[model samples]
Structure formats: structure tokens, C-alpha cells
Target: MKKLISLALALFMVLSMIPASAEAAYTQAPMLDGMDLPPVAERMPVEPMVEDADYLQIGTYGGELRRAADGGNWYNGKPIEEGLFRFTTEGVAEPNVAKDFDVNEDATVYTIYLREGMKWSDGVPFTAEDCVWFYNAVCLNKIDSKGIRNCHKDANGNPAVVEKVDDYTFTVTFGTPKYDFIEALTVDLKWHFAPKHIFEEMVQCIIDGKNDEALALGKAICGMEFADVGALGKETLYYFWNYPGIPTLNPYVLSTEEGKNNVKGQYYEYVRNPYYWKVDKAGQQLPYIDKIVGVTVSNVDQKLMLLLDGTTDFETVGMESIPTILESQTQINIYEWAGADWGATQIHFNLNVEDEHLKELFNNADFRQAMSICVDREELAGLLTDGWLGGGQAAPAPGQLGYSEAWATKWTEYDVAKAKALFEGCGLVMGADGFYDFADGTDLVLNIVSVADSGAADTYKVLEPYYRAAGIKCTFKDSDRSNIDNDLLANAVQVMLAPVTNIGDISIVLKPNSMVPGYATNVAWYGTMDETTATGDLLKLIELKKQLDVTASTEERTAIALQMLKLHEANQWTLAYVEAAPAYHAVNARIQNFLENGVWSDIYRDMGIAHCQCWFIAE
Candidate 1:
């Protein structure tokens, strides 16, 4: 399993000499011209990441990029996330923060090389110690260690041993060979390094049992003080944006404080980092845009209005909004990115419902089959998304790892007679109210729920008649998204309809929450598992997920994944509709160098790898 990525080899071979004057080497944003800052040559890494690739255009520096992120959580932290490595548009992993890395034989040990002379946004030198501190001190702290991040653990559930080899080098050794370690690093492990200078003393204070000192340090730096040192470290470092004083390596740093930003208006702002490490082809510091301005939007209508009125330069829109956006004749460039989704909307029944009658019915395979066949998938899709989604069955999309045609079409056909027969087989009888009643003659009414603002109610409204024709009564209920999650965890939801998007190629293994039980995504079987009570298929899925985690061989991992999918096909744990619709995001026509035809995936971290640093707003 020995492998090496030598992306920085060519970079080191032909190093460009820095000009005598800072102005000659690289240009800075006009906003920073008079600020007390180091010269560009001194601030940047000795071998800075050069953006001379043909795919990106050299952009001019200026203007604020107005983006709409609900509640100022910009792109779910994508814009500010700079990981150890990043995936290219071609889906290949490449070095980013770490210049290069090497995996030893059997893939148990990884040696990472950091770029020299790299500095945090606050001008403190970033070194291997920072990486080690993040892994050992913060992540594995004795006070409140939450254990290693799921992705960072190896197949055997063993955490890596992070050690600093030198100022610019570190090694991570796992107990077993982790073949897909690179993907794990690239996908989920953002913030591979932290600013040790800022947080180390506070952590030390906490570790030394000086609670008061730790609190004072945290409050003095970031205006954050938590009784628990672990929680304090986690919040300040993991969610660095909320704390203005936390240094970062990202292109932009949060410029607004908590009280400074309007609470009612819900505004947040970011300014370009003067010490950012990347440079463009023309020797200009990257992040062509000088600042990023974001606002919290109450609804999609507000988002669409911002797009139309030019208040926001970029925003992600749903496929259902395409018709409305097209009719508006707005000049915003709607980028139709290829979606990596198994289904747009899916249904899950609570297998562990507290009510015995509902639980027994939901667990009946025949009842579920009847439920699936009764819905006219195509009609529902047309009514809901204007036919933009093309309807679906309960299966993986064409390019998904374990996709099969038979599975794709299984139990998807609309056959009222077959459904009625299946219902009869389940001992359900037609009632006076034109709906089915349980075996004991009790009337059945499924309370369907979904995320409140997700437009799922409209989908459920269209689906009501289809279910009614099948002799099933259902009422669509709406609640806050968080409340819906709480309901799922509490086993309060009888049926749930929601969007399922983690269908990207690598997601089969990396993100198996929807397919595997115990997680919130598969809340139907959330608390129904134990040694004796676990179903054979459920046990098989658990085993397969474990195998997927540690199996380093891609071929072996795919084989295991297919086995799990086969079990899902036989069991029908969830039903699907409208799979693999194109994902849309609107950008101001003036913004340049944004990637086109990108694959929208959670594994790819959405827009994190889209080279936003190269995007410029044209005059």
C-alpha cells in the first residue's frame, strides 16, 4: 500500500526568486495598503501554491463577493475550510495545505510535509507542532476528549498516533493499513492544523487544572468562556469563525464580532487574510475578491429576491426553483452542477415506533411494498419539481457504486390492484372512511413529517391522493428542521419524507448513515438493535459497514458495499422518489473563474474545492 503524491516536486525544482520590493513580488488588496502588515514575499510560504493551471483565469483584485448563507454560516464553512489536501475537479486528490505526503507499505504510517515559511492569518509561523497539537491536545484532551473523528479512525477503529518529526514534517501512524486514508483526509478532516500560539496556553491551563486561568485566557482572546475546557477548545477551534480572534490559514477571516453584526438583520462579513499563502499566475496574492459579505435569509423567497435584486453575488438554489428562476429573466448565471444523489426525496417508516400496532405494520415487508407501489412516482415528480427530477425508485443512481437496474425499478411501478392485494395480505381491511384499518379494525392514520422550510409539504400534498387511492390515510405535518430531527431521535415520527443527498461515489463507504442503522438518517431502526434483537440483514449491514471502514482495497470495499445494497434491495428499508436531479447555484454574472460542470457532493465538501480564491468580480 505504499504510495506517494509528489505535487510539490515540480514546484520545488523551479522556485521563483522573490523581488527586492514587496510591490514587485505581488500586489495586495487596496484595503490593506496602509494597514500594519508584512510584505507579500515575507507573509507567503517559501514555496507558495501557484495557481498557473489552465482551468483558472487570472483574476483582478477588488470588490466584495456578496453570498447568501442562512444565518451567516457561509456554505456550511466551505469558503473558509482549508484542509491538508483537496480534490481536483477531475476527482483526484492533490496537496493543498500540506505540500506532499507519503504512505508507508501497508498504509499504516503517513509522512506529511508542510510548506516552509507558512504563517497563520495572525502572522504566527505554522509548523508541524500546530498539527500535532490539534491531534493530541485538543482532539484527545483528557478533560473532554470526544474520541477521534470518525473519519480519522482506521478500519479497526484505532485512532492515529500523530507525532511531529520536525518543524516542517509530521507523521500519522495507524494500527492497521488505511488504504483510503487520503480520501478521509481530503473529505471530512478540514482544519488539519490549528493556531497553536493562540490556544496552547489555554489548553495547558485547563490540563494543569487552572480553570480560572484558562477561562481568562479564552475570554481575553476570543470573548468565549465555557466552564468545560473541552467544549471551549472545540467551539473556538472547530467553529473558528464565531470567534474573531482565532487565527486561520483560509483566504478570508471573519471581520465581524457577535454584537457588531445586526442580530435582526443577521449579517456577517469576512475580509481577505493579508498573510494568505497562495498566489496567482501574475504574482498577485490569490482571493481576487477582497471581502465576503453574507446575510441570514428567512426563506427561499428572500434568497430568490436577493438573487434578482443583486443583493447577493452567489447562492445555491434547489432544482424545484429552476422554473421560477428561468421565468424571472434574471442575469444571474445559474450553474447546473451534476448532482451526486440517490434520491431527492425519500420515505422512512419508524421501525421502532413506540405504538405496537404501527410498529408491527411498518415492519411488515408486504405493507411497505404496498406503500411503495401505490405512489405514482412520475406524477408526483412532475407535480413537485416540474419534471426536472424525472422520478425514481428506491435504489442507487446509475453511476452510484452499487447501482443495479433491477433494484432501480423494484416496487416502483404504480399498480393500485397489486397494492390493494398486498394490503389485504397484510390483514389490513378497507374502512368506511375510504382508508385501511389495522387487523384489529382500528383506523390507521400516518402522520407524515418533514423539515419545515424544505417544501416537503408540497410533495406530501401531491402524494396524498396517490396514498388515498391506495386506501391509506396520511396527514402531512411541518416543524422546524431541528425539531424534526429531535422527533426522529425520540421515535415520535411515524413516517418521514426528506431529501437524501449523500450518494456521491465515495459516499457509499465514507458516508453510510442513510444505508446503515443506528444513525439519525436511518432513524427507523435507531434504537431497535442489540445482540439478540438485531435482524439478520441488520447484522449483515453492520458487518459490511465495519468492513467498508477498514478495507483499504477499493475493489474489496465496493464488493462489500454491493452486498449491503443487495440486502437493502431485499429489505426495502427506505423508499425513494426523484433521484439524481441536477443541483443549481446562482452566481452574479460579474463573478469570474467559478468552476462549471462540477459534481455537487458532500464528500467533495460542496463548493470548498471550487477555487473560490480565483473568483473575481468584473468591473
Candidate 2:
């Protein structure tokens, strides 16, 4: 009888080795016939509303706009200096200093005409010369400015050069024809104009007298490398600005007053740019708010609590806090969480590694596909969050550019059996210890790395069990935010949970070449361009992005978008997930026309706290 029992147990184990049938499989639905979604007129434009006389008029007066944020340097927000030309919201570019702009044939050259009479806050006349000089200081000269670089390289892979046409006008020429040149211009933070007078004067001082004072001034303004300003001609300035350019710009002049708090929060207040050129339809001078005060508070919980208490106007919240925030919704109205469909959250597979066993498991397209099937985003969303922060449609989050509900619904579904079948069918047999192993005797284990922050810590804990049940060994590693740079460069991480900038421009997010040096936001899983055999689909997506600038028809753009989506779905660069916590802005209840999106700082101009025109004190 004992022999019979032992034999029965052995038979059961043998049966388990046979692959189980999948409860679900990839279903190829009929290709969607082009159906007209809502007309472009019905959908929201990047800038949805023009000024209206009946627009809520608030008392335009002096008041400080207080905001709380996680740790960031004054250098970080220095891009705001680019004024009129910078991005206020995702995918939308409005004139900052330029009253308006004009583009030429093929959208390669952009002629930007600055609004005359605009001056630096210091009362110096801001001219076309200033614009040209500023461009040169940051881009052409590559001065160590706190701006972002937007222009493409020449055929030989050098920064594109700019030419000044006149005091009010300058033209930007790209190395390659860029359809989204204007979009790129608007989002490039490095395009911020510096006061040429201030910069040139410093350089002249250094050249006239190469003393310690002059050297100190040069270093203060341009860093230690600028000890000899004589060599810093137009060409030299271009490279200098590329790395650690002076964080100088017009929007918010930097104040030297030091703060007693953390260095991150020390001594920076953004005063209104008196030279700010944009005006309301009624001809009122813009930037209605008196001042913008950014306080550095690194703790996320403290930041959220401050928001609840009305000490801070805005705070970044994620999925873990959604339930808590929703449960306390009576405190305030949570504005739209911006990243609903911006991009996807993906489990990236490292295909370039030389390990035979690791490559065989990870590079197996079927294995990856099987892993994707078992991940029920809906269930994860429920377990991870609550309220509006739950499982959402895949692809671009809903309400974002290039989002398709049909595609989202078709791809995102829960089927555990299918995942199991695919796992077993791949010839991974279970061992006596209950862990699955491949034919060559390799066990499946994964190490996930995330920033050592509260949000990430909570998320990793929640996801631990799901991976364990699938016979996969899961390990979590915590990394400091400061070490993120070195970690990514050294390939010291396997999986990283980080927030990507959501500007709504797909080109910036997907292009392999887009991940330039200093632009560490790009997921490094793909490695640099020299390292990988980027598929034809990726190359085609880059080509389509270049076409976005000139393509006149939405249909053409949509077709390109669909192709990109199909590729993304098949390859899984991003794993689409729901926004866990929408951002919450607590106003004085008198503020009106406050446009809130998922992006931070996008609605500053429209806020009653920033632009006072739309605000009124409660009676």
C-alpha cells in the first residue's frame, strides 16, 4: 500500500510537468476600419480656449503664489526663462516672448519674431540681438546654461547653427528637416534666452583684467572653465552652454538670499518678468500673479499633507495614495491626474546580455508574451489603488494625444490560465522543489530596482507576491535618487520604477537617439544606439515622427500613430497602467480658469495664483 501511495505521488508530479492549457490566447481582431472619431473641432486643442470678455475677471493685484514640490534645483526650473516659446502644457506650444511665429517650406526653418519693447527684468531692452545672443549663449556657444537642447545635429553629428536675421527676427536651421521643429523648440528648455548684456560685460571684464576678481566673476557666472573669457567666442560658448551653462533666464530672476532649510530649497524666488511680452485680449499686461515662490520639500507624505492643509497648492501623488486621497476627497477636488495615457509602463527585457541562459529566457519573444498575458492590469490596479486611480485602458492613457480606447480594450485583459499554458508550453518543466526550470537547468529569477522612495517601496512590496506565485524569484533593490545618474550609466540596475516626463510629444519618448547625454530620462534598457540592433519598426517610428511637422491631415498622423502603437504593443517598451493618484490643487475658491493637466507647472499661467486676471476674492 505504501509503494502504491508513493507511485501515485510520482504520477501526479509527472502530470504536472505536462504543460497546462492557456485560458486565453492572443486574439487577432479584424483590423479596425478607419472610423472618424470626434471631429478635431470637438476634441480639445493644445490650447483649448481663447480669451473671452466674459471670462472670469479676478482682481489683478499683488499676491504671492506659494507652491510645494519635491527637491529640485533652481537650475531645474531655469527653463522657464525661455518665456513665450516654452511649453505650458503637453503637446501645446504658445508664444512666450514672440508675439507669434511663422514656419517656412517643409517646416525646416522657423522665423521667430519677438514682441518689441520686451525688456529684461533689469530694464535692459530685450532685442532680436538679445535673442540671437541668448541662443548663441545657450545653444550655439554651448554656455553652461540651465536650458535644454532641442536642435538636431548636422550630417557629421554636430549641433545645428543659428543665424540672426535682425533685432526682432532670427531663423533656426536644423541639420535634418524636422517636421516638429516648432514643437521641439517649444519644449527645449535650453532655448531660454540670457541677458547678453550681463554675459558680455562679465566676459569683457575678465578679458581686460585677468585678475582673481575677474576670474571669480567668470567662474561664478560660467563655472571654473571660463577663467580665460578671451577664448569664449561665439563658437566656444556653444559647447560651454551645452553642459553646465549659467542658470540665467528672464522668467524668474534668481535671488541670492539663502534659506535656512535644505540646500535644495534655499534662496530662490521667481519674480514676475517685467519684460514678459504676452498680453491678454483686453491689452492687460500678463503674468497677473505677483510672484511665484517654489519651496523645496523632499518628503512626499509631508508634501501631500501640506497640500491637504492648504500650505501648498500642488503636490505629486501616485497610485498608492489614490485610495487615501479619494477616501478624503471631501477635503478638496482632485484635478485631472496628467499621465493617464501619456505612455506605458513596461517590463523591459535585456536582449543584449551575453548570458546564454538569461538571454534564452528573456529574449524568447513567446516567454515575454506569456508574462504579459498573465499580468492582469485591472486586478493590479484594484489591489494597488482605488478611486479614479485604477486599471485604465492601455496604450497612451485616455485623454492623451494618440490614445485609442478601442486598442486599449482589445489588448488589456486578464487571463491567468493562458499565462500558465504559455509558460509551460515553452518547455520549462517544474522541478521537485516546485520551481520551474528550463531544459538546461536554469531557474527563473528577476531583480527589480527602484528609487528608494516611499512610493516605490510600497509598490514593490505589493507586487512581490504576484511574481512569486508564477515560479519566478523576485528581489528588490533600493537606489538613492542622487545615484540614479551613475546607476543608469553603469547598467547597475535591472528594472527601475521612475517617472518619465510626459510632454505629450511621442517623438521625445520613443526615439532611440532622443536619449542624448544629460537627457537621462529615457529608459536605458535599450542601451545606446551603438549597442543594439534597433528593429526596423523603431526606425520607421522615428521617420514618422519627423513627418509630424509637415503632415497637414490628421488622418495621416493617425495612421502613423496606429503603426507606432502596434509596434509598441508587440515589443512592450512601455507597460500601460492606470494613474494611481491625480494631482490636487486647492485654490482660494475665487480663482477661475485654472487649467489643470497631469503635467506639473503646465497651468501656472492660467492659475489665479500666477495670472491674477482670472481670479476674484470671495465676497
Candidate 3:
């Protein structure tokens, strides 16, 4: 008996010496140590999102990633912003910030379940209230001055109601069936939940009509005063990077104080969020890199040099830079991402032009078809992209969803005789100067406006000779980008040449302005019709848009989108020079885990959907 007791005592002693077995915890970056923050497990949600995709490599944490931001910090914003859901390479909306979600039978209600313990960068718990607050304060109240968007409403035009179910769950109920609402939430960044705790008091002040108090609170948060509460709220909420104190759900938070002032030649830095709520398969907290450093390069030359020298980690380059990248191999690795742009350079003739004759000509299907077939797209493609990209119509590519061969190939054939005949059919008379004149004997001169110093200008230059050969007189009007933008907004642009981007199958559904009309971005048809005049092709498009609004299934939505494109094809509303081209991005070889051939889509959030959290710098 004494020997048995001794044996048990010995076993206890051994177990005690071995130490109590604690729960396995995730390993956070060493930089987070001694920060007086919670443990990795505590900081994470109840069930932290595990990024264990086959392509993901367990990366070591340390070192800073250097990237160029020629435009502004906003260029870097998309990669970091987290919405309720994220777009997949296939343009499907998958779970992201929201752990899971459910839709009712008719799809009028969406119940979103967020991660239970997820916290904002500031360590405040993120809840359904944040989303509800945004709906009530911003959407319902129109604090941003942009009234409730059409998508946010139902068929009856009643605003969607957001109701909080619990701290981590909420439901959005539309007055009518909104089947594509989940995709809508994924595509639109404005719908993402805001940090209500940060903005509550100021919002209350604004709601109470205490303008002075609201301005003071906003000034304290943003470090700048605004002319009004609306401007103040928008800059503070939408442009959160400019005010870093406002918490973020992003992997990294801006560490630089410059904020909005981090302009050309200035540098900006982003530090990894210690409270980031994701982990790799190996149980290491992400993002793998310690920091992201944004450096400004004034020109493409400087950018190219930086890329070759490995001073910058990554930068998107055009096909024109392919030769330079190949010649100077250095430490740069080049790969192509499937481009989403449908029209490399598309022409939009203002259908609402004040000149009656011009408007009639622009609206005439034969006249538009004549202009389209006049330009030799094959030669234009060669001149523009050195034959890298093939000539295509003003429609989605074959590989893209919603692509219709019948629609895409329509009016795309290069036939000068056919074009001239069609022009004559439209009442255009051949004049003494080898140019066509209007039916009323007025000189048929079109102002082909484009943003100055842009690729659109180059396209216009190439198209000028074609237009001249086709007996169409047009003057290239290169205007400032801001001026062109203002004109587009005011529907004052007569004939504009611009890149028609983000026209992917899913993108078109979200931003249908390019084809459906009635939007400032729809320079082709903005102000073209009123309630009385909305008929024929426009009426068909509007009805199709209604179907798209309530379409839940991806297949049905795609079908509806194709129908809309068919209308445009039949009408020849827009003209195209080149089709979608593959996008090339150069990355420093040291940048590990960067997606080599990810889909390059603005709708898919570019690198944001590439799992940037898994990227690391090789030692």
C-alpha cells in the first residue's frame, strides 16, 4: 500500500513538473508583444476566420512592403477595406466580415451574422449596431447629402429597413424582393458598417441641429473643420484613412500623421493591426508583413526604375511597359491578371445634345453603326497595344459572363463602303472638303472630347485618320480631367472618348449606369429621355433593369444583363476601338504569396480579394 501511494505521488510530481497543458493559442507578430494589448486569442473573434487556402503559404512576420501611390492614399484604400462580404475571382460574393448570412424565400430579407468577438482597430467591439447606426444616421437621414440610392430601395421605392437582432447579427428587409442585395452589399463600399461609437455623439449633435457642436466634434476627430455637417460627416466616415483615429476593420491602419496631406512626393506608412481577426493555417496571426509603406513616384519613368531596382514592391503596368520589364529582368517578376475593362477606348455620343440635328444624328442607329464600322479596329488594336490585344466590340469579352457573340460582333466589321452608304442613308451628304454635311447643309463637325494627357487622347489621335478617311470631320478636344468630369456630371459632353472600365458581368449589374442611362456616368444617354419619351430601346433597358434588381440567382442575373447588352448592340448606342486587355502587374521577387494570375477587376476589389493578409517579404 505504501509503495502504491509512493508511485501515485511520483506520477503527480512528474505531471506537475511537466506543467499544466494550456489551450493552444495563435502566435502573433513579435511587434505586438509588450504593447499592453490582449492576447492574440483574446483579440480575435470567437471563431476567427482561418485563411487556409491551398495557395496560401505560412509567411513569417517582419519587414515593410513598399508600394507606389501616384494618385493619393485612396489608391491604397481598397486593398484594406473589409465589407460584409467580398467578391471572388469569379465575381461571386463570399463571406468576409460577416461570418455567414441567410436570405428569405423571396429574398426580401437578409440576415447577416458577424463574427461574435470581432473588434475594431481601436479595441471597441464591432456589433450590428454599427450597421444599424449607419443605416439610420447616414442612409435614412441623408447625412452625406447624397439621398438614398435606388438600389437601397424596393420596387415601390421604399427604403430598406435595417434591424439589429443581436450584438453580432442584423437583418435588412426591403419593401420588395431584392434578391441581389447580398451582391449589392459586397460591391458597394458605402454599405459597409461604420464605427458607430466613434461617430455617435457628433451624429447626435448634427441630428439635434447643433451645427456648431457637430462641427467642433468633427474637427476634433478629423483635425479639420468643414463648411457643413454633411461634408464633415462624409470626410470623416467615408475617408476614414484621412482620420486615422477613427477605427478600422482593415488589416493595417495608417501610422502616418500626414493623412490627407500625404500627397505627391510625400510618404505614408501603415502598421499591422494588432487586433486583426484572421489567422493562417499554422495559427499565426495575419497580415504576415509588419507594415505597408506608400511611396510616391512622380512619373512612369520613376515608377519603372523603382520596380526594376526592387525599391517598390508592386505596381500595375500597361502593355507598353512589357518590353522594358522583359529587357530589364532585374528582381522584378511580371504576371498578367485577367482584365475586367470591356472597352479599352469607347466613344459616347451625347444623345441629349442641345443641337437638334446633332442629337438626331447621334440617336439614329444607322449613323451610329456607320461611325462604329468606319474605324478599322484591327489596325487600332495594333497601333494601341502592338497586336497584344485583339479588336473587339463595345461589349463584354468572350471569357466574361453575359458575353453574347451576336451582340459583341454587331456593327464591329470594318467596311468603308458600307459605312459611307449608311452615312448617306442617315441624310449625310458628301461635301466638297471630302467630309459629310448634315441634312440641313450644316458642316457635320463633332467635338471628340477626352481627358488631356490620357490614353483616350492617344486613341482619339489614332481614330482621327480613320474618321478623316471615312469623310467624318471631327476635332479632338483635350480637356482637363476635372473639367471633363464636371461636363459628364452636368450631361454637357457632346461626344466623349473614354475608357469604359468595370464592365464585367457582375460589375455591370452593380454599376449599370454605362448601359442603362439616367446616371451622370452614362454620358451616352444621360438626360436623353423623360417619363413621356422613355420608349423603345430605353424602355426595354429600363424593364430589364427592373428584372435585374430582383434577380437572386447568378444565372438569372447574368441572363438579364445579356438582354440589356442586346438592346445596346441593336441600338449601336456606344462605339468601341479595342476590347478588354489583360492587366500586367510587376512585383518585387521578394514579395512572397502575391497572386500571380489573379483576376484584375475593380469590382472584385483587385488585390483586396487576393488575400493580401497572406503576403510576406522574403528574408
- Candidates sorted by TM-score, best first: 3, 1, 2
Question: Model 3 RMSD to the real structure?
Answer: 8.7
Candidate 3: clashing residue pairs, number: 0
- Encode model 3's per-residue lDDT on 18-80: one tens digit a residue: 111221557899888899998777788876767765677889989988887655434677677
Candidate with top TM-score is: 3
In model 1, which runs have C-alpha deviations exceeding 4 angstroms?
A: 6-24, 74-76, 141-147, 201-221, 224-235, 257-265, 323-330, 350-363, 427-448, 468-495, 499-507, 518-534, 549-552
Error of 2 at 253 (Å): 3.6
Across 1-619, the per-residue lDDT of candidate 1 in tens digits comes to 4364445544432443333454466777777788888777788887777766567787888998886656533253675678888776666667788887888778888988998998999899999999998888877763323346655677666678999999999998888777777776775565677788888898888878888888889888876566666667655766666557778898988765674332224776777889998888778888889887777787778888888788888888877676777787877788888766666667778767788888778878898899889988888888887777677866777777677888888888889899999999988989888899997889899988877766787778788888899899988888875476567667688877773233334456656656676432456434344324456677778778777776767688878988888888897877876666676888878999888878877667788757788898886
RMSD of each: 4.0, 19.0, 8.7
Task: Score every model by TM-score.
Answer: 0.86, 0.69, 0.87
Clashes of each: 1, 39, 0
Stretch of 10 with least lDDT, candidate 2: 23-32
User: Which candidate would rank higher by lDDT, 2 or 3?
Assistant: 3
In angstroms, give how far residue 562 of model 3 lies from its true place: 3.5
Tell me which of candidates 1 and 2 scores higher on TM-score.
Answer: 1
